[model samples]
Target chain A: MISDTAVESDTAVETQRGLVEIYSTTKSFHGNTVLKDVSVCVKPGSVTALIGPSGSGKSTLLRCINGLEPIDSGVLKVNGEHVGVVERSDGFYSLNRKKRALQRVSVGLVFQHFNLFDNFTALENVAIAPMQVLKRSKSEAYETARSYLDRVGMLERADHYPSQLSGGQQQRVAIARCLAMKPDVLLFDEPTSALDPELVGEVLDVIRKVSASGKTMVLSTHEIGFARQIADQVVFLDEGRVCEAGPVEQVLDNPREARTQKFLERVFG
Target chain B: MAQHPADLMESINKPRITRKTKTEKTAWIVLAVVAVLIVHTLISNPNFEWATVGRYFFGFPVLKGLLLTIILTIVSMALGTLIGLVLAVLKIMNITPITILVDLYLTFFRGTPILVQLIFWFNIAALFPDLFLGIPFTDIGWGINVNAIMTPLVAAVIGLSLNEGAYTAENIRGGFLSVGKGQLEAADSLGFSEWTKITRIIIPQSLPTIIPATGNRLIGMFKETTLVSVLGVADLLQSVQLIYSRNYETIPLLIVACLWYLIITLALSYPQKKIEDRYSKHKNSGGKVTATTEGVKLG
Candidate 1:
């Protein structure tokens, strides 16, 4: 009876899908603030692109959403569940390691450098999290891993190690690794920035496929043109705060804020 | 068309050799002569007693001593590597008190001579005559004599294992340090548990760095086992000493010991090379890994 109730609550939580809401989130490293009072509402199935210059805290904000790094102050919620912290009547308490890992089930992060495990084949890389964390059967996980690899066009190179693959191929495998987990929201940190000029298109093409599939994705990117084409919402961050965020067209083309206009001129000019 | 063959050959140009090239050829000839002379002196020396060495090479006592040496090296290395792995992880974990404790252990064991440590362990009864096997600070306990339990062979194994653990810990720590920080961040971002991160990601990648150093240590440990002869334990060196003492053929027995050591080390080298090659195969071609991460900015 208790197990049945637990399953019911789990499904109930799944059904009540909510927007990813960041409420006045502040994050710092040592004495310096990387994200100061940053808040953004990402509706379900929307693709948001975070754009700014180097040290503009775009990556940090993406990291905060996935619970990879913690916020010093404020609540970050995904589908109405607090991320990385739990708030009580008295105060907020940080989640433990296991709880934080559980929170990560709702989100997946793809790194700019495609940090695939060097010793593992592309298939093993994708299958590991499912077998280890999700406790899925080996065959089941491998089947899911293979399907995701096929989706990313890495099925042919499934047995290749990361060192044996090109940067574009490795990044596609990395995307498959994230997709295999079946997370609700996907976060990409400069996914194509680390690729060679000719190779960038292959990775961006995969990301475009994922974007069109309507998965909630937040990507920090330097590619203004790609961002303009894909992102439903464009967030322009300067220093540690969000400068201007709205429809991608207005934020990227004609911005009201002087900082946003200046940044766009410098980047798109 | 009808010119003589010699005249035709002279018509074609010949490459010139400079004085520097002639000197380089002479240098190679001189090195070859020196190497051949050294080989000749060693092989042609009659006093080496090749007959006695061949007879005693597979002799019972010498074979027994060789077996003991092999066992000691294997056992001590296993113990040392296990302890070293634990110490390396503890140091990296940075638990202040435990890190300081491990530091003291490394300093004391690595700082002193291995021979001295062997002697110290052999006479450990002087420091603690009785060892209790019960709860600490409790009156209810059973005590046993330390001297009775500590044999010469046991003392040697303990000494070698403790000393090797200190060096192995540093090697392992260096291995872990050689792994890029981006690897750790990627594992963390994937939400792998700390245990999974270390076992799956960190240790596997650290193998290329760790395996070669470990192979060197294994070879050193094999030779270092001879130090146990100082304790009157009948290891390879001591067995040779016993045979020479009985027959007064000291140099021959010494030659026998050297030959055995050479054979064992040569045997070990093959597998070591195979292991190194296996781990390094995947690492040779990867382009620049992620650039050294930018330090987190501080106000």
Candidate 2:
């Protein structure tokens, strides 16, 4: 279906800037193919939610998109530039560590377990990357960090370390940390999965605000309701394949694939 | 409405009661008695030659020797730490040839005894009479006379630092490993260069694990400096030996040296503990509170 759309709208692809384009990407660990020929296109300033069961390749697809995990075959590009690999005259060549790291500057990722730097306070956690990676002045980075922390409603607790904050607060700070980087694309892999049930809403609310700000985002989530509320497009995966892809209503409410239907029914029930 | 809620709350809010263990009192008494006995022995024993200890404790020669010992400890530890950090980073980088080289260095330095190392370093002039100080594989540098430069003091510093570097490297490597894999992934996602990631993230986060172990190594290093006395470098112990050999007051001068070591060790321990406490504060208070006053609700 994605290839069919690509064929139909080849001209449209050129105009779309700062978009994530994953075409027939295959990733495997050992003998197990975790992501099999997955194609996901995240348009500029839009949220695409990937919903699937555990071990259904949602996380793997997100990781591959950000170049955190290398794909076995196929092209994975963020903001129209290849991530983790470069195309040569002969074939695709995996980039060296330094070049790959430079390519990752355009993309950001939020993990399920909020991986905030424990040694730094919440504000420093958000600010350090901008200062170090972007070569921003300390004051400029801190100001940007304060603004993002305010956006996440964590401004007052900016002085606290990750250990002192609850799971929900840590995730909010993690989101703010990613935002401070000012990447063209953001990927969230089950951002709320490791959070306590009651704490999930605060993080989701912050994400909802981010989505409204019109940043390009791709999130793999188990929260069906939250995904439906925020995502412009929804992609459903089953056993390493994208089973269905369309508008949120079509995928969540009127899924055509039997697998997506079964999965949604089980999730909704 | 039989009783007021305030009274009921007061009744339940009494101070916590804990039973005192009878064995603790017994142990305290035993400890006090043992301490008194030791003090009495030190004061009353004529063999101690307390006057001689006092006379030489602050003597010029002893003070000079003490200064050298302190210098050796500080210089060797600082050099060793620098070497350890470089080696640890190289090991983490995992370039096969460099790793093997680091492994060989660690094995040679740590496997041999310090005494032997000191002696060997003092005699290194025998093996290499002259050393070059410039570009390798080409005659582009000045030649250094090994015999002229390799003094007892230099040999002691080199021997102690090399051995300490091996141990410090292991400690620092453990510290780096103690950091969670998640931290590195987060840094990677932010497009941090390898140097930035290690310097800004890995090193800072590993401090809580590194600081306490490094403190232990530091205190050990202070005591280990005494071993250099055998090389006749006139450190604290060597000074005491010189005096005792002249005056025939071995036990008294030895007591003086022992007293100075104890006092300095105690002094070093205080700051070591303070640094360890500062670094590990987060670990102690983690999960004890929430970001907001909603802590009560969360509970």
Q: Clashes in each model (backbone N, CA, C under 3 Å)?
A: 0, 0
Q: For each candidate, what's the DockQ?
A: 0.24, 0.41
Q: Which ranges in model 1 have alpha carbons more than 4 Å from their true place?
A: A1-18, A30-32, A88-92, B1-55, B134-144, B277-281, B287-299
TM-score of each candidate's B chain against the true B chain: 0.85, 0.87
Candidate 2 residues lying further than 4 Å off, grouped into runs, are A1-16, A89-91, B1-45, B136-139, B287-299
B1-299: candidate 2 lDDT, tens digit per residue: 35569978787778999876899989999999999999999889999998999999999999998999999999999999999999999988878999999999999998999989999999999999998899999989999999999999999999999999999999999989988899899999888888887877777667677778888898899899999998899999999999999999999999889988899899989998887776566456662122211211100
Worst 10 residues of 2 chain A by lDDT: A8-17
TM-score of chain A considered alone, across all candidate predictions: 0.94, 0.93
Candidate 1 on A187-250: residue-level lDDT in tens?
Answer: 9999998999999999999999999998989999999999988999999899999999999879
Residue A220 error for model 2, in Å?
0.9
- What does the interface RMSD come to for each candidate? 8.8, 7.4
